[model samples]
Target chain A: MASVARKNLFEDIPRFLVAQAGIMFAVSLVTIQTGILNGFSRSTSALIDDSEVDIWVSAEEMVNLQLTLPIPAATVSEIHAMDGVEQAEAFISRTTTWRSPTGDIAPVQMIGFDPASRMFRMGQLTEGAIANLQEPYTVIPDRANLGALGLDEVGQSASINSLPVTITGFTRGTQSIASSAYVFASLRTANAYLNSGLTTTSNCQLEGDRLTCSNMFERDASDIALDPPRALRGSDGITFVMVKAQPGQDLNVLSRRIEAEFDGMVAHTQTELSTLTRNYWVGSTGIGFVLGLGAGVGVVVGVVIVSQILYASVVDHMKEFGTLKAMGASDWMIYRIIIEQALWMAILGYIPSIALCGGLGWWTFATQGITILITPGTAVVVLGITVGMCVVSALFAIQKVTHVDPAIVFKA
Target chain B: MVVSSLQSPVTYPIHSLPAPAASSSYPVEHQPRRAAIAADHLNMVFRSGGGSYPALSDVQLRVPSGIVQLLMGPSGSGKTTLLSILAGILTPTDGAVHLLGEDITQMSRRELARFRLENIGFIFQGFNLFPALTAAENVELALKTKGVSRRFARKEALDLLEQVGLADKAKQLPKNLSGGQKQRVAIARALASDPPLIMADEPTAALDSHSGHAVIDLLCRLAKERDRTVLMVTHDPRIIDVADRVLYLEDGKLTQTPQS
Candidate 1:
C-alpha cells in the first residue's frame, strides 16, 4: 500500500456533529415519555387513595367507577364474616353543600361511612386525629375546608344541614372530583342531614347458604317534624358497599362470587380502580388524547432529525469516499464510516437526553403532584430507539456515497 | 505532430503478446498472481435523451510490466470516459476490461467496485480533496477504508505526503493550500495504496504554467522511480515530451495527428 499520512480529524468531527443532533432528539423523546407517564401515574394514585376499602366487590356491569350501584347491606356482613377477611364497610357518596363556620359554604361530596373501620381511614391526615370522629357530634373536614371552617386543630366545630358538628380532624387528598370538599361522617349523620330517608333494619337473613337482606328504611313513612334519633336506610335505595378480601383469597374470585350472589352491585379491585380512573381521564376529552399523540409525534421527529444529519454528512464527503474506493477499500469499509457516525451520536445523545428528561419529570411532579416513574428499563429502551434511528439513517447515507465514481475525483 | 514508427497500423492481436510480457516487469517476489490492469477492445456508449453517443469504439490498450503511457485528446474526445471504464466507475457497453488478466468487465457492480478499490488510482481535476479533512487525513482515509490498521496506515500516509513534498502541510485543509499544493496532496492520495496503475485526468489543469510543469515532472518522476505504470489524460502539449508513449483520440476514434 502507498504510504500517505492523512488528517485524523476526519474521523472525529462529523461523528461529533451527528451525535449532538441525536442528543437533542433523544432529550425531546425523554421529555414526552416522562410527561405522559407522570399524568397517568398521578391520575391512578388519586383514584386509589380516595376509595374506602382495600378491596371492593362490584357488579360486572359497571366497568369502573363511572356509575355506583347499591348492594344490600347484608353482603357487607357476609364479607366481614368470611375467614381471613379483616373488615368490611358500607359507604355512600353524594354532592352537596354545608354551612361553613364563617357562613360562606362551598359545594362538597359528603362520604357516609363507618368511622370504626381502619381500612376507611387510610386518607392522609392534615391535622388533629380521626379518633375525634368517635360519635355523631363530630365531622372530619377535608383539607380544603380548613380555612372556611376556621378550624386550625381538633375541637373546632362546623355546621352541616343546619346541625352543628365539631371539626374532629383534617385530611388531605380527599377532594372528590373537581376539588369538591369530602365530608366524612357516620352514615346516620349524613342520611339525617340530607333528609335522604335512609334507614337501618334487622331484616338480615340467610337464603340457602348465602345471606340476603334489604334496605332498612321504613316504607310509606311521612317526613317527621323533628330529626330522627338515628339514620335510616330507605328500603329501595342505598349506594355502594366496600368488601375487604381475606388473606390468601383472590379478589377476582371473591368478586365473581359476589356478582353471582348479588348481580345488581358492581365490584372492583384497587388496581382496577386506579386503571379505570386513568382511562376515564384519557377518554373524557381531547386534551389528554392530544398530549399522548404529541409524544408519538415527537418520536417520529427525532428519528427524522437523526436520519437527516447522517445523510447530509454523507453527501458532504462524497469525494473522500471516492478516494477511498480508489484505494482498494471495500464497500464495507466505506459503510463503517457512516455507521460509526450514527453510533457515536446515539451514545452522546443518550446520557444528556435522559438527564434532561429526568430533571423535567421531577420538576413537573413536584409542582403538579403528578407521578413520573422513570425506570431504568424506560431509559434503556429510549437509548435503543435513538441508536436504531441513527443506524437506519447511516445505512442510507453510506449507500449514496459508496456508489460515487472514483473517476469524478479524477475529473475534478 | 509526432508520427507513428510503423507505416501501417501495427494492429497485432493482443492475445499474441507473450503472457509473461504483461507479468515480467511487476515486482512480484511472493504473490506473482497479482495482475495490475488489462483491457481488451473496450467500448463505452453514453445514452443521452436524444440518442446514444459512443464514447469509446473498439479501443484496445494495455500497460504491461511497468510503463508510463499518456492518453491525449481534445474536450469530448472520450479520454475521461475510457479512463472511467478502466477504473470500474463505468461499465463498457461491449468488450472486456481485464485487471491482472482477470476480466473486470464480467464482474458484478459490487465486484467491479472491489476491483477499483484494489487496483486503480485516480486523480481528478481540482484535486477533489475533502474540505473537512487535513491533507494528511485525506490520504489516511484511503488506507483506513482498505481495512489497514490505524497505526500502520497513519505512518504510511505521512510517508506518502512527505514523498509528495507536503509533509509540512499534512495538517492543512484543502482550502488552505495553493493550486499546485492541493494537486500534490491528491497525488499523495493516489499513491496511498501503491496501486500498479494510476489513471489521472488533467492532474495539472488548474495550475499555472510553472506549477503545471512541476506537477507533470513529479508525476513522470514518480512513475519512473517506483516502476509503476501511469496513464495521464491531458490536452496540454508541454508534458508530451515526458510520456513514454502517447495515444491521441479525436471524435471517439484514435487519431494519427495532433490538432495543433
Candidate 2:
C-alpha cells in the first residue's frame, strides 16, 4: 500500500498541494523575516550599529543614558588633559516635540553635539546631508523625520523647542526606537533655550588623570572642595562633558579612574550606553513587548491559514481512507500518508517564502535604514515552525482517518 | 434438505470413488485444520442513541478448505454482518468464530487486524480500488501491506494482474477500467498475499454474464485446484450452481442446504 500511496500522492499533487504551498509560503516569509529583524537589530534601537567603545559618563543613578547627565564644561576640558586621555567634548541630549508648519507636533530626540566632533559623523545619512555643526541655526534629521517635517529639500525650516532651524541636510540614524525622529544641533544653541537665557560658560575641564569642576553650577558652591577648582569661583558654563578615548584605549578603565578622582559621576562607552538605552526602551517602556506581541499574532495567523487548507484536503479524500483501511492498511499507514503529504507541502512552501522574505527584508533595511539580517539558523527555525504547524493541522485529519471503519467502504 | 445426512456424515478412505485404472488421484482427507472458517452460535449487537439493536444472532456454519461456500440472503439479512465477522473485521457479541484454528472473537483489535492481513482477503461490491492507482499498483498495495519489498511486490502484482486477465491494463487507473476489469483487479488484490481464505461481498454483482461466469470460474479453480478456501456473499442464483455448498441467512440465522 505504501507503493500505491506514493503513486497516488503524485497523481493528487496539483489540486491539494498548491493551496498548502501558498499558505506555507506566507508563513515562512513572515516568521523568518521577523526572526531576522529580532536577531540583527542590535540594541533594538531604530538607528544604531553594533560597535566597540569604552566608557559613557552620565549623571549619577541616571537611567536614561542618552537623555541624562548635566556635567559642567570644566570637567570636559579636564578629562581631555587627564592621564592616558585623548579628547573631550561637551554633549547634550533631550527629548523634545517638533512642531511642524502644519501644526502637527511629534516627539523627537534633540541630540546636542560639538560641530567639530567625530560622534556627529558616526552615522551615514540616507537623505540630504549632515548638519554643519559651525552653523548656529541649522539641524539634520532622520529621513523619516524629513517626511514627517514635510521638509524634502535643503533650507526647509522646522521648529525644535519653538526655535526655527533650517534642515541643512537629511541624515540617517535619526530614530530612537520606532521611528521617533532624531535631530542633531549645536550644544551652545541647545543650552540657550533650556534655561531661559541664563546661559553660563561651563567650567568643566580634563587634566592629569582627573576631570575637576568649578562647582559653580552647584547650589552650595562654597562649602564643597573641588580638585583644581577655578581661581575665580563665579563662572557659568555648559552642563555636560562627553569624552572620547583614542583608538585602542580602554575607556572602561579610564572611566573608573575618572569616577574615583571626581566623586558623584557616571561614565560609560558608546556600546554599553546604547545597550542600556535599548533595555530602558524595551523593558521599562513596554515597546519591545508590543513588537513581540505583533510577532506572536503573526504566528497565530499562519497556523489558522495552514490548518484550514489541510482540513479541506482531508475532507475531500475521506473515502480514500476508508478504502485503504478496508484493504488492510493500518492506522499508522494512513497517518504516514497524510504527514508525508503535509511534509512535501511544507518543503515546497518554505522555498518561495524564504525568497520572498529575503527580498522584503532587504527592501526594508535599504529603504528604512534599519538593519535586518536573516541567518541560516533562523531559516532552519522558520522551516521547522512551518512544518510543525502543518503536522499539527494534519493530526486532525489523521484522527478522523483512524476512527473510520472498513465497514464504511462496503456500506455505501 | 438432507440435514440428517450431514449430521450422520460418514468418513471415507482413499479410492472410495471409482476411478479408472489409468487415472491417478490425490488424497481427499479432511485434515480438521482444513476447516478454513467455523462459526458456532455467533451474535452481533449494535448500540446507538437509546438502545441496543441486534444485527445478528444464532449464526453457525463451517466452511472447509478447498471449497467455495456461498452465503445468500436479502438486504439487511445479516449477510454483510456475517462476512464482517468471518473476515476478522468485527468481533461477535457471543459465540466463537475460528479462522484457520484461531478464535478471532478473542483477538485484540490489533491482533485481529494482523490476522486479517495475513489470513483473509476481501473483495468489496464496488471493487473499492483506489481511483488514483493503476491496476498493478492496486495489487502491489496489497502485497506491500503484507510486507513485501517494492521490487518483488511489483513483479508479483504484475503476475497476479496477468492471472486475473488484466495484464494489458496493468497501468490503467480505476477510472479508465470497465466494471468487470476493476473487479478483476480487486480479485487480484485479494489474492496477492496468498491468504488461506478469500471473502467476496457480491464479487460478481456488477459484472455482465460472461464476466460473472469468468469471475466465479476463477474463484472455483483457485479453490479446487490450489486448495484455497472461498466464501462469497451474494444473492445471485447464477453463482449458486458453482458453490460446493450453500448457506442461507435470514434475520441473522444460518440454514444449511445440501445438494442432491
Candidate 3:
C-alpha cells in the first residue's frame, strides 16, 4: 500500500516538486538562519570558551567580556594566595588604534597575556610562531583581519597607539562579533601602549608591597626650552584575572571562595562566564529575537505550503479514494494512504533542503569568513520540524477524505 | 418458469422466508440455493431544494445463491441506487437489508465495511483500478485488506488473474491494457476475496459488445461454477439472456421479467 501510494505521489515528478518547492524554500531559510545563529552565539564567547583557565575574576559589575571594567592588579596576588589556587595571572583586554603600513588606522581589540604563565593560547597560526611574542613590541593579528589591518606579511612593521610594533605571526578563528580585529600581544607591550606616559622602565619595577612606580629625572636646559617632562606612572590595573586551580580542585568551590574573600571583584567559573557572555549577546541584544522570529516565520510558511499541497492532492484523488471506499476500505485505511503520501513528501523534500542549507553555510564561511555551524544535531532537529509540518498537512487532507461519499463511484 | 409477475413485486422479510424449493427454470444440479441478498420494503428518497424525490420506493428483493441476477431499468429508474443500498454502500431511507444472513442495516459503518470485505465483491463501470498499480497489485490489495499475508496474496492474485485469462498481462498497468483486459482485471479483483455475493454497476458499459459479452460470460461462469451469487445492473439487452433471473425497474418500482 505504501509503495503504491508513493508511486501515485510521484507520477508527475515536475508537479510534485513544484508543490514541494515552497516547503523546501521555507525549510532552507529556517535551517540557514539557525546555523548562523548558532555560529554567532558561539563566536560571541569564543575567547572565554577557549581560555585555558578554571576561574575568572572580573570587576564587580562586569556583565560580559566585551564590556568589562578595569580591576586592580592586586586581585591576582590575593587570588594566588588563596587555597586551591595553583597560579593566577592578570589578563588585559583593551581596544586601541593600529596604524597600518599604508597609514590606515583601524580599531583593534588587543589581548595581553603573560606568555610565561601560558594562561591564554593564541589561535592557529597561519605564519610565524606564538613563541616570538616574548620579544617586546611584537603582536599576532588574526588572519581574518589581515586585509583590514593592512599588514602584508609576518615581518611587516606597524604601530599600536603610536608605539612601534612588528607583526610576528597571524592567527585564525579569533574573529569577534563586535567586528573589531583582534591582536595578541605580551602583557608588558600592551600596558606600555594602552597607558600613555608610562615609561617602559618604571612599568617594570614595583614599589614595596604595592604595584607603584614613578619616574624621577633632572630637568635639562634644552627640555626646559621645550615641553616639560611628565611624571611616569605604572601599569597596575587589569581588566580580568585568569586563574588555574590545582589538580583535583573544584572550580565552583574556588570561585565561591574567591568571591567571599574579595570585596571589589567577582569570580566566575569558565563555563559561567561563557554562558554570561553568550546570553548578553543573544538576549540583551535583539539579534537572538530577530533570528527567532525568522525561524518562526519559516515554520509558518512551511506549514501553509505543505497543507495547501496536500489538500490539493486530496482533491485531485477524490474519485480514486471514493472507489477505494466502495471496495470496502475503512476510514482508517484512507487516512493511512494520505498520511503515507505526506510522509514521503516530507522525507523527500528534506533531502534537498538540508543539502542546500549545508552548501549555503559553506559558501558563507568561505566568502565572508562568518562561521555557520550546521551540525548533526541541527539536522535532526530540522528533520523533526519537517515531518511535523507534513503531518499537520496530512491531518487537513484526512478531513476531506473521511467525508468522501463512497456512493459517488456509482454515478455516471 | 417465472416465479412472480412484473406488475406485482414480491415482498418478504428474510427471516420469515422459507428455504427455496428446486426450480425447473434453473438447472437440476443448482437447485435449492440459499438467499444471498434479501431486502424488505426498501425505500430511498432524495430531499433537495426543489422538493422531496424518490429514488427507490417500496422495493423488496431476494437474489438466490449461485445464480446470476441482472437488474435493468431506464435512466432515473434507480437501478444503481437499489444496488448501492443492497451492497451496504448506502443506507435506505426506510427498510432493512440482510446480506449473507446479517442485518447490514443495523450495522455501523465500520462493521458494514468489514462485512463487505468478507462477503461482497464489487466491480465498477469505470474499471476503477488504481492507475499507479499493476494489474496483479489491484487484485492483491483486496486480499490484503482481508488480512491475507502479502506473499500469499501476491500468489493468489496472480492465480486469480490467470483464472480470468489475463495471466500474461499481470504486470501491465491499467492504461497499457485494452478495455476488455482492464475489465478482466476488475473481475479478478472482485473474485480475490472469494466473496459469496458479487455486485457490479454497469461493469460492461464502458467496453465494446465483444468485451462486454466476454465479461458477462465470465461472471456467469464464476457464479455457476463456484456457487456464488452475482448481481449486476445493466441496460444491455444482449447480456440479459445470460442471467438466471432478470428484474425490471421503472421509476424505482421493480418487476420480475420472465426470460424468453
Candidate 4:
C-alpha cells in the first residue's frame, strides 16, 4: 500500500503538489489565525495570571480587569481580618493619560500595588529593580512600548495625568492586547494621579424630608476645606483588594467566604478571575466568534480542495482499481490504498505548512510586536485536524472507488 | 444442433472425450480430470431505466480441468457475461455457477472475492496494468493480494514475468511498454496467484498477428505445462487449433464445436 501511494503521488508530481498547496495554504491560515487569537487572549489576562495573589476582591459586576471600578481600599483590612486570610493589599489599575517625553498624550494602563507586600509582583523587568517603584514619582514602563511612551532611558521622566514620574525601570513582554502601554507604580503614586483634582465637599440640598449630601466637587484655590469627608480618601479608595490565602487554606473556600461576607464586592480565585477577564474580552467583543469563523472557513476550504483532488485522482485510477479488484484484491485492500494516499498527503502537506507558519509567526512578532505563539500543543492539534480533514475527504473518493465494477476491466 | 438447457442435476459422461493430444505435457492416465467450472440454467438480465434486457437465458457450460478451453462468439453474444459469472465477478439473475466445485453464485460478495482471490486468475482485454507501477511491481501486487510476503512476491513476480518472456522489461512502467508487452505483463500478473483456474477475455484482441499468436501460444503452453484449467474467449480463428475444446455461442446459446 505504501508503495502504491508513493508511486501514485510521484507519478504526477505537479498535480500532487497542487493538491498539497491547497491543503498547506488552508492549514497555514488556520494556524496563524488561531495562534494570534490565542496569544491575544493570553495577553488580555496576563496581569492577573502573573500576579502573586491567590484571590481577587473587586467591585461587584466587574466583568474584566480593565473595566474594574474602584472599591474602598478599607476593604483590605476587612479581608485581612477574615479567617483563612493570610494577607491583603490594595491593588489599583487605571487607564490614565501619560505625557510622554515628546509631550504627546497616550493612554497607559497604570498598575499600582503595595511595594512592601508580596501580594503582587512586577512583570519581567529588563532593567532596574522592583524596589525602585517605592520611590516617590517612580514607575516601570513596558520596554515594548518605549518608543510609543517616549521613555528613552531608565532615568527619563514622564507624567501620568500631569504628575511627573521618572521611568526607574523597564518591564518586558507586558504589552496588553489593547495596545495600551503598561506602567507600574506604587499605590501612593497611582492614587495621587487618580485623585488629583477631586475633593470632598458637604454641600447638602434639602427637599421635603430627604437630605442628600453631594461631597464630590472640583477643588479650586479660593475654596477652603469646610470639613473632612467622613469616608476614607486618597489611596483608601483603590480599584481592587488582592488577597492571598493562608497556608493549607482552599482558595475557592476563601473566595466564597469573602463574597458572602462582603457587600458591594465580589471575590474570585486567580484562575476564575483570569478566565472571566479573558472571556469578557473574547466573548463580549465577538472576537472569539470572528476568529472561530476564520478557522472554520479555512477547514471548509481545505476539505473541498482536498476532496476534489482526491476524487480526481480516484477517477484517473479507476481502471487501475478495477484491475486490482479483478485480480482478487478485496474491497478492504482497495480502501486501504486510498486511505494511505490521503494520509501521505496530509503528513506531507503539514510538514511544510508548519515550517512556513513558524516563520510567519516569527516575522509578525519581530515586525509588529504582536506575539503569535506556535506552541508544540498547537502543532499537534493542527496536525490532528489536518489528518482528519484529509481522511474525511478520502471517504468521498472511497465511495467512488467502491462503486466501480471490477468487470469493467474486461470491457474494451 | 441446439443443446438442451440443464434444468436438473444430470451427469456428464467423461469418457465421451477424445484421446489427449500427444503433445500434451501431462499424461491422461495419471490425471483424474474434474470439471473446473459448471453452470446450470444460468440466466442473466440487465435492468435499466427503460426496461430489463436478458443477456443470457438458459445457458450451461462445463470446462474440464487440465485443458485449454476456448469460447468463441460474435459481438454481444454474452461470452464475457458468462465468463464473469463463472469467475464469481458477477452473479446471474437465476441459476447457480459452480467454480472449483463450490456454488459461487450463492456466496456473499465478500466471500466471493476471497474465493476468487484464492481460486481464479483473470486477464482482461484492456490489460489494465497499473500505470504507475513497473511491470514486475504490477505482477508482485497480485501475488501480495494472495497473502504472499513482500520478498517472496517480488521473487515470484520476476519468475512469472520470466515465464512470460517479460523478465527484461521488469523495471519498465506500463506506459513505457508496448501494447503487446503490456498484455504479457498482464499475463504474468494473472499467473502470479497460481490459481487452479485461469480466465482471459479477448487476450489477443489489441495485438497484431505476430503478437497475438505469440500471446496465444504462451497461454496454451503455460496451461498445459502446469496442468491448470484455462478458459479463454477469442474471435481469432488462427488460435483455434491450440484449444483442447472449442465452445461456440450464438444468441446466448452454447454448442460444442469439434476441433479441426
Candidate 5:
C-alpha cells in the first residue's frame, strides 16, 4: 500500500530537515560523551589487557594497576612453585618524577620487566631496543612522549630521582595513559633506580641543574659495568607477579591456589585483573564519574529535544492522522509509520554522528597527546543508544497521535 | 462504476418508517425500497464543563436506496450530529443506527471503521481536501484506504476526476483550486471507493450560489446514475431542488412524521 503516513512526513521538507538536524545534534552529543569515557577506560587498563598472563599476584588489598603497592620479591619464587604455573616473573610499576634535560620536571610511569619473560608483551620496540636495555642505567621512553620529556633524540640524558640515565631507544604503543610519559627499563636498571630509594649515593653530583654520576659518565653506555648504583639497593620488592599458566591449565584453579598459598596476597586471572584495574580507576577516581555524568546528561537532553521534534511533527499533521483514522486506518498501522520515521532518522543521524566522533578522537590523539578511541565496540553501543533514543521519542509522539478525534475532519 | 439495480435483494430487515421518507424516491413501484440507513429512537446529548445539553430528541429516519435526501435545519439543530451518527462517525447517546443492514451503534469502533471503509463515502463543507496532496492524489488516498492497489487507485482517481469535470486540474493542489473545483475534488474522492452510500455535510456551503448549485448538481447526477443513496445536510436552499426529499429539524426535534 502507498503509505499515507510517509507522504504526510515528506510533505514538509524544511520541517523534516529540521527534525533530522535535531536527530543529528542528539546522536553526536551521545557519541562524543561515550567515546571520551571509553578512552579513559582503555587508557587505565591498557597494560593489564595487553599482558597475556594467566594470573597476577599484587600486594594486599590491591585495587588497581594504576598504583600497585610493593609485594615481597620472594613471592615470585613461591608462585613459581605452585601447580599449573608455567612461568612467573617479577614486575615493577610506579609513577615517579622525571626531570627533563632542561630541568623541566613531569611525572612518568616506569615499568621494569625481564626481557625473556613472555608474561608481558611490550608494544612495538625499536631495533635492538631490548638488547640495549641490558646496559645499566639505560631506559627506553615511548616516542610519543619525546616532546614532553624534553629529549630531542635517542641517547639523550635524563634524570629520575636524581639518578642519571640515558635514553637507549624509543618505542611506540607504551605511552602512559594517565596524563604522563611511559618509560621501560630492564630489571637490572629498575632495581638500581627503583630499589635504591630516592637518592643515588654513588658519586652523584648536581652539575648546572643536571644530575650526573661522575663515575657513570666516564664509561661508554656499551660498557655495561660502569653502573655501580645497582649495588646500593638494600631490599628486594616488586609490585606484581605476572604468572603464566601451562597449556590446558585452568586459570581459576591456579588463581585460587596462589591466593590460598600466600597470606595478605590477592590473585586474579587476566580478565579479572584487567576488569579490577578498569573499575578501580573509573570508580575510585572522580574523573570517570564526571565523564559518565556528562554522557548521561547528553542522553537526557537528546531525548527531550528529539521528542519535542517528533511531537511537533505529529501535531503539525494531526489533521491528516485524524483523516486517516476516519478512513479506517488501524492504530498499529499508524504507529508503525511513525516508528519508521524514527528509524529513518536514527540511521541517517547516527552515521554522521559517529563519523564526527571518529574525527574528534583522531584530532585529540594527534594534537593533545590524549587518546579518545572510538572502537567498533564503542560505535556499536552508541548506535544502540541512538536507535533506542529515537524510538523512545517516537513512542512519545504517538501519545499525542492516539488522542486525535476522527470527527475533527468534519470541522473544516 | 458498476451500478447495482434498485431491485437488489432485501438482505436487511425493513424497519417501519415514516411514509414521506419511504415514498420520496422509490424507483421500483412494486419492489420494496432497500433501506440504506435505518435509525430508530435516536437521542444525542453533548456534555461539557458547563452541563449536559441535548442535541437530538428521539429522531427516527429511514433513507431508502438510490435517493438524495437533504437534511435541513437552523444552526445547532443537530443536522450535522445526526449525519455523523448515521455515518458511524459518532455514537448516539441513546439509539441504534443500521447502515447497509448492519447495526453501526452496536459495532466496536474498529469494526465500525472497517464497515465505514467498505460501505460509505463522505464529502465535507470546506472540501476537506488534504492540502499537501494533489487533486488526484487526494482522491487516490480514499481508494487506497479501501485496499485498492497503488496503480489501480491512481488510474481510478484520474477517472473519477474526469467524471467531475476536473481532469485537467488533477495535478493541482487544493490551495490552487477554486471553491467549486476543490468541491469537485472532494466529490471525486467520495466516489473513488465506489461505496454504496455517500454522506455530505453542507458540502456546498462555502461556494457561491452558481458554484454551489453546480457542485450539488454534479453530486446528485453521480449518486443517481450509480444508484447510490446520498444523505446530505445543508442549509443551502439553492441545492435543495435536486433532493428527492428535504427533512427539516427545529430545536433538535423532527417536526413531521407520516407512516408509509
Candidate 6:
C-alpha cells in the first residue's frame, strides 16, 4: 500500500531528511554541470547568433572568428553590388592588449563595425545611440570588464596597440569564453589598433570610394603576413564581410555565390557559422567531456545513495515484510512499495535542484558576465533523470527483499 | 517410515485431545467429515553447498474445518516447515498439499500466492505488524490484498479490530500497543480476508500465561464462529484443553501416537 512506503520513509524523520538531502545534492550536480556546458556553448557563438547578417564571409587565411586575417574592406563593396544583397558591412575582430588610463594592460578582443550599417546592434546597446560609435576613435566596452581594463567610466580613455581610444558608451555585460574582454569600436578605431590607420599611407588609402591597401602589413614584416601572398592584397586588416540578403532571398544560395566569386574565402550561412563556432569550442576542447563526466558522476552517486536508503529500510523491517509475504503479498506489491518511496524522494528533490540552479545562474552571470542557461526544458530533463535514478535504485534494493524467505516471519 | 508416522487414516490420535469446549455446537467426532487441508507423503529437504538437511520427512496431515489442530514438537522437528508447506509458502520436496480441495503444491509460486490470499490466513509468533502503521491500517493491508475496495476496507478493518477487543487501540501504531494488544491486531489482520483456514506459528510464545491464554481463547472463538479451520504450531502444553486434536513430530517424523 502507498501508506506502507510513506510511513516507512517518514517513520524516522532524520533518516528521511538525510536521504532527501543526498538526492538534492545529486540532482543539483547534474543540473549545474549541464547548465554550465550550455552556457559555454552559447557564449562561443553569442555574437554570431545575435547578429542580423544572413551570411558571414571570412578571409581564406582566417582560423576562426577570434583569430583571422583581415580581408579588404572592398569585399563589403563587392557584396553590396551582388544581386539580392540588401546590405554589407566590414566586421573586424582581433585580439590586442588594452592599456587603461591607469596604464594597466589586459587581453581584449576588439570588434570593429561600420557605424553606418549598425548591423552589430550598437544602437540597442546604447539606447538608440548608434551614433556614439560615429565619434572618431570612440569605443564601447562592457561595463563589467571596464574595471578590469583600468577604465571606470564612459568618458575614460584606453589604448589598444598604443593608440589612444575613448570610451563613448558602455554595452551590456558580456564575457568571451576565450578569456578576452569584448570591446566595440568603429572601423577607423580598429584600423588604429591594427596600426594600419597610424598614418594615411601607413596601411591603406581610399582608391576612389573604396578603402584599399597602399601597402599591407609587411611583405616582409614578420608580424604582418601570416601567409605572404595573402598579406600583399590584404584588405588592410578587415576580418570579415557580413552580408544581409534582401527579403525572400535564400541565404544558402547567396553564401554559395559569395564562395564562388571570392578567392581564399569561406562563405557560410548565419546558422552554419554559428554551428561552426559552437563546434570549435565544444568539440575542439576538453571542457564538454569534462562537464559530461561531472553529470555522470552525479547519477552514479545518486544511485548509490538511494539504493542504500531503500535497502536499509528493507533491512529495518525484515520481519514485517516477511510477514506480508506470508500473508500472500506478491513480489510486485513489495517492489511497488519501495518504488513509491523513491518516487517521493525524486519529487521532493527536484524543486530544490532547480532552485539551486537558478541561484547559481544569477551569481555566475552577475560576477563573470557569463550566462548559465537553465530553461524549462532543462528542468524537465533533470526531473526525468532524478526520477529514473531513484526508481532504478529502488528496484536494485527490492531484489534482495523479494528473494528473502517468508518463513523468517515465523522465526521472529 | 511414512506409514510408521501416520499409522491410520487419521494422521494423529484424535482420541486424546479433549473436545473443544468452545466448539460445543459441533462435537469432535462430528467434525472431520471433510478435510479443509490435507497433505500426502510430504517431504521437505534443504540443500546447501555443504550438505542436505531433511526438515520434514514422510509427513502426512489432515485438518478438518470447524476445529482447532495443535502441532506440538521439540525444536528442529520441522513443525514450522510442515505449516509452511500446507500454507503453500513452500513447495514440499515430495508429494502434494490440498487446501480447500485445491491442489496447492502443484501450482507455481505465483499461483500459490493467489490461492493463499484467497483461502488461508497467517499469524506469526511475533505480532509482525508494520511498525509505522496503526493497528487498523495493518488489518486494512490484508483486506486490500484480498481486493477489498478502499471504501469497505477501512470499515471492515475497524470492525475486525473491535471483534478482537481492540477497538480502543485501532489508531495506535504497533510499538505503542502492548504485546497482547499487538497480537489482537495480528488476529484482526488475519481475519480481514475471511479465509476458510487460519494458520499460526507459536502464536502464544511471546505473551505471558494470562495474556497468552486470553489471546488464544479469543482467536479460537473468532475462528470457530466463522467455521474456519485453525492450525497452530506451538510447544506450550497448557492449550490442550482448547484444541480439538493434537499432532506430534519427532526427528522430522510424526509419531503414530503422541508421547503426551
Q: Which pairs clash inside model 5?
A: B19-B258
Residue pairs with backbone overlap in model 4: none
Model 2: runs farther than 4 Å from truth?
Answer: A1-48, A73-92, A96-107, A112-123, A127-139, A155-168, A177-179, A185-262, A267-275, A284-309, A360-379, B1-33, B49-52, B215-226, B258-260
Candidate 5's C-alpha runs over 4 A off are: A72-86, A115-119, A124-136, A142-156, A168-180, A196-235, A257-265, A286-289, A375-377, B1-32, B48-54, B73-77, B129-144, B147-185, B206-218, B250-260
Indicate whether candidate 2 or candidate 6 has the larger lDDT.
6
Task: Give the per-residue lDDT of model 1 (tens digit) for A85-167.
Answer: 66777666655567766777766666777767656653677776666555665767766456544556777666665556677
Name the runs in model 1 displaced over 4 angstroms.
A1-34, A45-54, A59-61, A72-77, A87-269, A276-289, A303-310, A322-336, A339-354, A370-407, B1-37, B165-173, B176-181, B208-225, B236-242, B255-257
Whose lDDT is greatest here? 4
Local distance difference test values of all predictions, in order: 0.65, 0.67, 0.81, 0.81, 0.77, 0.79
DockQ: the better of candidates 5 and 6: 6
Provide the TM-score of chain B versus the true chain B for each model in turn.
0.84, 0.84, 0.87, 0.86, 0.87, 0.87
DockQ agreement of candidate 1 with the native complex: 0.36
Where does candidate 3 stray beyond 4 Å? A99-106, A116-119, A147-159, A196-235, B1-31, B258-260
Highest TM-score: which candidate?
Answer: 3
- Estimate, for each residue in A1-412, the C-alpha lDDT of model 3 and write its tens digit: 3376697788768778886798798788788778878888887788888878889899888988767888877777778998999999888888899999989999988888876666677667889887787787789998778889997789899887766788998888767665488888877767766763333434445668777666654334433242322222233767899999999998888888998898877898888998998888888778888887898889888888888888888888787788778878878878988888888888888999999888888887666667777889989998998899888988999999889999988875
Ranking, DockQ, top scorer first: 6, 3, 4, 5, 1, 2
Model 5 vs. true fold: TM: 0.81
Report residue B178 deviation for candidate 4 (angstroms).
3.0
Which window of ten consecutive residues has the lowest lDDT sum in model 6 chain A? A223-232
**Per-residue C-alpha lDDT of model 6 across residues A309-403, encoded as one tens digit per residue:** 98899889888878878887888888888898889889988888789889999997777666778888888898999999999999877888988
The Cα RMSD of model 1 versus the native structure comes to 8.8
lDDT of 2 by residue, A1-412 (tens): 3444345446667755666555655575456546544633442443333222245566676675455556665677677788866777766666667877666787766666676666434366655544464466567776645656666777777666555666667665445444356777667655532432222456878998899876433222321221121221113344345666777777778888888877777776676666776677656766456656665665666566656666666565676677667666778888887887777667777787778777776776567655455678768877887788778867877777778777765664
TM-score for each model: 0.72, 0.76, 0.87, 0.84, 0.81, 0.86
Clash numbers, per candidate: 40, 34, 0, 0, 1, 2
Per-residue CA lDDT of model 4 for A355-396, tens digit only, reads 999988887765565777789998999999999999999999
Model 4 over residues B156-219: C-alpha lDDT tens digits? 9989999999899999999899888998898888887678889999998989988988887887
The DockQ-derived docking category for candidate 5 is acceptable
